[model samples]
Target: MADSTGKTDKDVAPQIQATDVQVEKRASDDESAEKGVFEHINLNKNISARIKNPLADLSPAQVLRDVEEFANEHGLVDVLPALKKGALVARDPDHYESVPDMTPEDLTTIDDEVTHKWRQPRRLYFTIILCSIGAAVQGWDQTGSNGANLSFPDALGIPEKDNPNAARNQWLVGVVNAGPYIASACLGCWLSDPVNNYFGRRGAIFGSAVFCFIAPIGSAVCQTWPQLFITRLLLGLGMGLKGSTIPIFCAENTPAAIRGGLVMSWQLWTAFGIFLGFCANLAVKDTGDISWRLQLGSAFIPAVPLLIGVYFCPESPRWYIKKQRIKEAFESLRALRNTELQAARDLYYIYSQIKVEREIAGDGNYVTRFIELFTIPRVRRATLASGTVMLAQQMCGINIVAFYSSTIFEKANATVTEALFASWGFGLVNFLFAFPAIFTIDTYGRRALLIFTFPQMAWTLLAAGFCFYIPTESRAHLACVALFVFLFAAFYSPGEGPVPFTYSAEVFPLSHREVGMSWAVATCLGWAAVLSITFPRMLAVMTPTGAFGFYAALNVTALVMIFLWVPETKQRTLEELDYIFAVPTRIHMRYQAFKVFPWWCQKYILRRNVTLEPLYKFDGVQTRGDNRAVKE
Candidate 1:
């Protein structure tokens, strides 16, 4: 039975399936070696992903020694016992009895963490709530301008309609509305990093609150378009700074399991602010020429609470750790977590992750770190992913309705009063729909919600546009348009509304987080400026049907980009994402197209029972048995 020179047939190797081969090559050092022969070959390949816990295999003695060294180096020798036990527990959260210096009380609280995960400390809730209130300032500003759009033109002697200069006035109106967005995109977002470095998160937030408070009052008093534009731009400075900082502040303070749900309060409170603006608009509709002024000035109301409340909250422990103040970091963590054990565990774990992060990102100046978001392999992937979601938020066209629903209704033959009511309905739907995301975003996950809702939003939006073709004389004309628009708001509130900011906040390594967020926020608000400026013309040229169809197509386009590029980060710690993003873009896209697409077709389309292959191998285990993706 010999085949080769002096070798028996028993020595011959058997053929392996491509799936088996890919699984086998998971440990290979070369990225190209992991590819199946028929798979797309990538010229610009990244290194292999190495996924493991840095402290998992350390013995109790080794854990003690590591803690001792960390404590000694950081001048924390006084709390060595707690540090040792915490280090051990962090290394094995599920297996804590074996950890030394353990108490019965500690065991009970740690056990309760699994059974009662939502029972977080009051200080933790308060911090997230107060910080998230900053988003109200942003939302109120947008809608105050929206409500003002109706009357500001006439007040400034530039009528938006029924005049010889109507076309020019529309563009001018668009420009005036676009001012805040432009200022935020260009200046306010870019200032986030330096501001955070100099003033810390609380200081930056307080400073932004001052601007949010003052700018709205200036907006209320302006007699000319130029003066109002100046005030709006000043509002942008605060909006950009607050918007960029608040989400990160929320993300850092929250537990990974509940992070997305908690952090999405940024969008939730924003919806609330929009609702309040509508109420204000209604309140002043009969006040002659002063209605728009009252609407614009009322935005300062949210800023009032934000300014007074920020200093009362606890600082982010990760921010403290980043500054190398381990003691203060410990104290901050204690306030945020359920127990001292939890605090110590976080302190040690975060410290470990940050050390690895520093090595990955390297020591660099702000400009250098900003460049690394594109240059470094891991960071570049995060940048591209976050940037896509941010850009997609604008492309989804919710802002079209948010900024101009009143005008859109008026154009559809409703009186000005009816239009205000319709805008308020859209705001109500937006705020109410967001509540479901708090329950579903963690369980159903970020990518699932996005994939599920994008198509729904597209069709609903398209339906609303087609309703514009309905006879203007019919009572059902405006009603149909309003119904579809409200439906679109419902679909949008849970998916694209919450995903963009939440996704962008968590993607980057801590080393580049502030700068990366600035980039992501700038991309969002920058495109928002373009949309705001162009939409007046889009309405004039394309009409409502054409604009709706246009953004509907973009919904599909955004879905494709999300499916191909953005990885799900639900329930994942910020540090754990380094491994997830390490898998190159080509590999992720190929798996989605070739593996997942086929499995989806079999399971959902053809009604056949099938198992989809898992993309991620976390903690050296290949997850199986109908577990939804933590996919690349």
Candidate 2:
């Protein structure tokens, strides 16, 4: 057809070449289209990289280096992809804009918000009311014994604080408070199952509430000091047992992200209870016969609402899942989350993770579960770190400050009312600073705060000790003590106080967390009990300077402990941590060797701190209900 106007075949060949170029371009386009949606190379790999690298490097140095080279060589091409292509793609402006961006379709609202909602949900509201009441009881117990030395003589029919028989009253007052704390360590663990199974969290809490209610009333009616001690012991048991359950219930019910903060409300309320008792003391300051019994008895008032309200609250979804009541578990999950579909998704997600943890933990008896918690290297490390931090927390001279504030102030030459007022400042600072943790903990993170603040606390303690040792009754000495004391309390409230409990709750496996926490609490109480008993004796022997010096050294040790141990738990989910730590692969590096050490020590003990990678990797794991993969 072109021949009618054809100039030459060569010109026709040029036209044909153009047509061929078009066909080739179209073929390339079709090939790319068939390959589909830009071929995402699994961002999952990027997230899992930290987990994988550690695993690949296990063994002898030669083997590790060889594996590293192989991985690096093989990874070069994909890892070095062109940045231009990544920059070219633009996200759609409108696609996700309308989505409400609800808390995962699987996750529920946190406890604090749920407790504070405009039309408060029944479970959260009731739980808060119950916990608050329990906290108030705890407050009463802690504060009831505060003025015991002053009034015990009258209450117990002793003639004076120095009565040879006064040891009985002193012992009753101090030891009685400790009894529940020690008993709680065992009872909480032993009773958790029955509480969860025979009765729900609600029922367990209700029983504890009943004890709180009765113990206080009994405390008021006791004619003999022994009777008073027995009642206080019962109250302690209730508080300890019930207090252990709060972390469990709060942690299990809330989302992983904010669970730590929510559970901390228990302590916050505990402080508030102390504050209330202070108020009560102020109210009754002038009344001579304002019996210690009446002060103790007032603890029961809050329990009335809790005893009545807790029965209406929901059971733990974790507990339900443990019992294999999947339907009821899902129902509980939904009620907590405030939706069915999302609740089911979260339930399934948690249920699967729980299944994984159980399998990884292996088949074992109850005692074995206890052993396994500490047997795994990673979990054991976490447990040791948590327990040590707690140890440091108690010995950091805090409880001494708290238990003997009046005495300490008096020794510094302050009057009784002035000492009490200064102690009030300590309480006020504690309460105020604590609220910031609720807001910033999830943001600034647990590890950063602990590490940064502990050193500050150590230095403050050192300086305070120096101030005390200066041999002065000057106002400057008193002022220095006051500043450091308040600073120390502020540091403890946000950093150590809530963090140990939060970290311990987060790190331990769910199956063992209840018992582990019970024991951990026991350790905390055990150490505090020891220190409290000995502190008075130490004060008598060493005087303030020696005692403060001893505690200041303890702070230094705590700082070192925190440095050597303590991994970051910020923004990590409980399930991910479990899988990460289970990996058998970990780097065992002895940074330096001390030549004179025993061969046995060299064989079994680390010469210096060792950094081991997690035993396993769940870096790429994705929950069924959430798109986000495991955080490394």
Give the root-mean-square deviation of each candidate in angstroms.
Answer: 8.8, 16.3
Which candidate number maximizes lDDT?
1
Model 1 clash count equals 0
Q: What is the lDDT of residue 166 in candidate 2?
A: 50
Per-residue lDDT tens digits for candidate 2, residues 1-632, read 12212234355334332111111111112223321111111111222222211111112222223223332443422312211111111011011122233244212332222233233346754555465566667655555555443465466675425667655544444555455555555454356544655676666777888788888788778787767767766776677667656666766776655566666776677667666665565555456665556656777876777777765666778877776676566567657755443353355446545654653455455577668656765556557766877787776777776566655666666665666666667666766677777766666777667766777777776676667754556778777777888888788777776676667666666666665666566667667666655665566567776777788778778866665555556545565455334322222112111222233254558564444343223333322112322321
Candidate 1 per-residue C-alpha lDDT over 186-287 given as tens digits, one digit per residue, 9 for 90 to 100: 999888999988888898899889999999999999989999999999999999998889899889988887899999999999888888888888888889
Best candidate (score: TM-score): 1
lDDT of 1 at 347: 88
Model 2 misplaced regions, further than 4 Å:
1-133, 153-173, 186-190, 362-365, 376-379, 469-479, 583-618, 621-632
Worst-scoring 10-residue span by lDDT in model 2? 84-93
